[model samples]
Target: MSQNVTFDDRDQSVLNYSPGWFLTGTYNATSVGQTGTLASSSITNVNVTFVFPTPATEFFYFGIKRCCGGSYLICIDCDPNDRKFITIDAVDPTDDGQSPPVVLFSQKFSVAGVHEVILMNQPDPAFGGNSQITLDRFELTVPDPNAVQPTSATSANLFSTPTPSSTAGPELVGSASSSSSNLAPILGGVLGGLVILLIIVGIWLLVRRRSRRTLYSEEQATAPGPQFQSQWRPNSTFTTLTTPGTTISTTTSRRELDAGRIYSTYTESADDPLPPEYGQVFNTAGPSESSSLEPPPPPLPLKASR
Candidate 1:
């Protein structure tokens, strides 16, 4: 026998068909008939409980319709196991046609008996009149023992739990802060090294320039003094003279001299006075020559008037 519960019949008492099933909530049992179908009223904080029959298959399905745009939270409580929650956001379409129903919950059972499902309506005030949900149907299918299990069952969980969160927002912010913090030291080190190098280069250049200047100054101080040339001039006139046995001609030139020596030029003459060193030669001269020599002049009386 197929095990299913469908809320489409518009009869609220049909829900009592399964003795193991229970439902409670503050909501209307049915809505006004529209076209060929009827829908259940929107409900909030609803609870549904049921027991799975033994020897049943692994899949169960729950169908619901979103009447408006809003968010909802569904929580399932399976005893002796962890509770699980799923959040759903819905949007109303612009088309006037009826929106299709979707599977609100599905699970594969490991150990199943009694299970409670809680639905929390999170209506958005911004959605105005469109925030609601309606129940359509539910099914518990028992597939053939030899049949292949569908891949879609992996998403469905019977006693599934949410893992710990690994959000990236905080980690990204920390990394950015760390990088910025390290940047200052790196820049400082580079700038400091550059400044020291510039100082060293400046000192080197200054010392080199100073040494060059000093060498140039020393060369100037040790250099030789200026040299002077001597000027010469010839006499404007020459004198001619005669001697008994020889004729002579003489001319003189003038030149400036240093303090160490004095020079004078004169011609030889026979009438020139003889020095005492030549007295013997005069004494040896002939008597007639001696008589011809003139006598020396007498000195004046010192006191003739006295």
Candidate 2:
């Protein structure tokens, strides 16, 4: 249901209508000239009463045009038993084209009742003239009950679903497998390098050991034996007899004798006996008669002849 209530200066019956609505205040019914192609008036402390057929379950829009004043105070007493009051201040617009109707109150009613609307004007202290409130129109509207109310449930469910995350798990697993696959060549390369390094180190160690063994063998082969080492001395002189009549003298320095050479000395004795084999050969060549056999006769004859 919709209703538009307008106040015209020519309608004096609108001021005294008490069956459903009435107005009481100090107001000039037709004082100001026509404002914006409609009759306008100045009102102060005006109280307007409205009786609805049933409870007001919709919204009320009030159109007010305020002139030069301090401020306008408007109050709506929607329920007298519960008595919930809504107060609003209406200020003059900067220009006429910028002004629009304002919704005074929107509520659902419990029972059919009467609502009171009170308007009061405050004078501008600086201007010090008569303060007034101009009313253009009032509209009451009831909305359709069967109209669907919009909600965010469908939009909220779009974010709450886990469809994208179901595929994310497999993607992460595949990434891990791919990462392992990529690292295989790198690990193999590092291991191969380490094996090559170990082989080179082994070859180097074998070569070093063989070289050391070869050096030790050469030293052992060239080294002096015990017999040659016994000849070395700090100070020594050597004389070699080649024959009975020849002699060779060798003077050895300390540095030269330290070379670890061999030296030998030979000596001959006159009383030294020959072996038995040499005696038997000499006896075989000469006579076997002993000196004691025929020695007396020979000794007497030799003395007589002397």
Candidate 3:
């Protein structure tokens, strides 16, 4: 049967149906049906209802269960165009042989005032069955705008305050400066060690040159005099004194003392001539002048030549 019930903002109602055929469309099932199938084998009826209000978004649900039936019954849903009306698989109850059935449908329609909605037998063509569905109770409620949902807890309602900078403190800046200052001593120590090494090497070279000069002086003092003259080895590679006609063998140990003063004494050889200063001493082979056998001369009076 087809039925209709109009609803507004404040009012609510329920529709009643019976076992015999009638013409009713959509209405509310807020209350129990009066004259439909009760919990017994004598009647099997089906009830459907619809509701309309001001256009709004809403949710809908329904309940179906057996009041009483001898057979194991079901409430299966089927496509509207199928021939055989199918019921869902039923569970047999041991206590009262009653099984509860539930079918729920929902849709949102945008229309202003009273609008017509349809509720059908679903897969019904021949339209009458002893096994029935009964209307219990339903809800058509509107949600409030101000009501909080679960998402509100984690949402960012507004911008959060910015966190302070990590390096804002002066103590952190001071610590960095102090770290660089601590490295200064280590850098200075390394540079100081390199300078000291250079100075030590320079001092060692000066000491070594002085020691060589002292050794050369000692060697010159211990050398033989010109009476027992032996040729001295040349210390350096170059020669200084040269005679006009004679090829003179070079002497090494003689050094210039001052102007017109030489630390050298000459020895005459038969092969080479001597200078004029050593003329009497050069070839006096017997009883040379101022021999050791000659007497000492008388002492003269001392006078200052002024």
Q: Could you tell me every candidate's TM-score relative to the true structure?
A: 0.30, 0.29, 0.24
List per-prediction Cα lDDT, in the order shown. Answer: 0.49, 0.46, 0.41
By lDDT, is 1 or 3 better? 1
Using lDDT as the measure, which candidate wins? 1
Give lDDT tens digits, candidate 2, residues 170-223: 756786699899999999999999999999999999999999999999999999
Off by over 4 Å in 1: 1-39, 50-64, 78-84, 95-97, 111-114, 125-130, 143-306
Tens digit of lDDT per residue, candidate 1, span 165-205?
A: 56657756676688899998999999999999999999999
Which scores better on TM-score, 2 or 3? Answer: 2
Ranking by TM-score: 1, 2, 3
In lDDT terms, how accurate is model 3? 0.41
For residues 164-240, what per-residue lDDT tens digits would candidate 3 score against the true structure? 57755785567558878999999999999999999999999999999999999999999987786666555433334
For model 2, what is the alpha-carbon lDDT of residue 115?
54
Error of 1 at 47 (Å): 4.3
Model 1: per-residue Cα lDDT at residue 92: 51
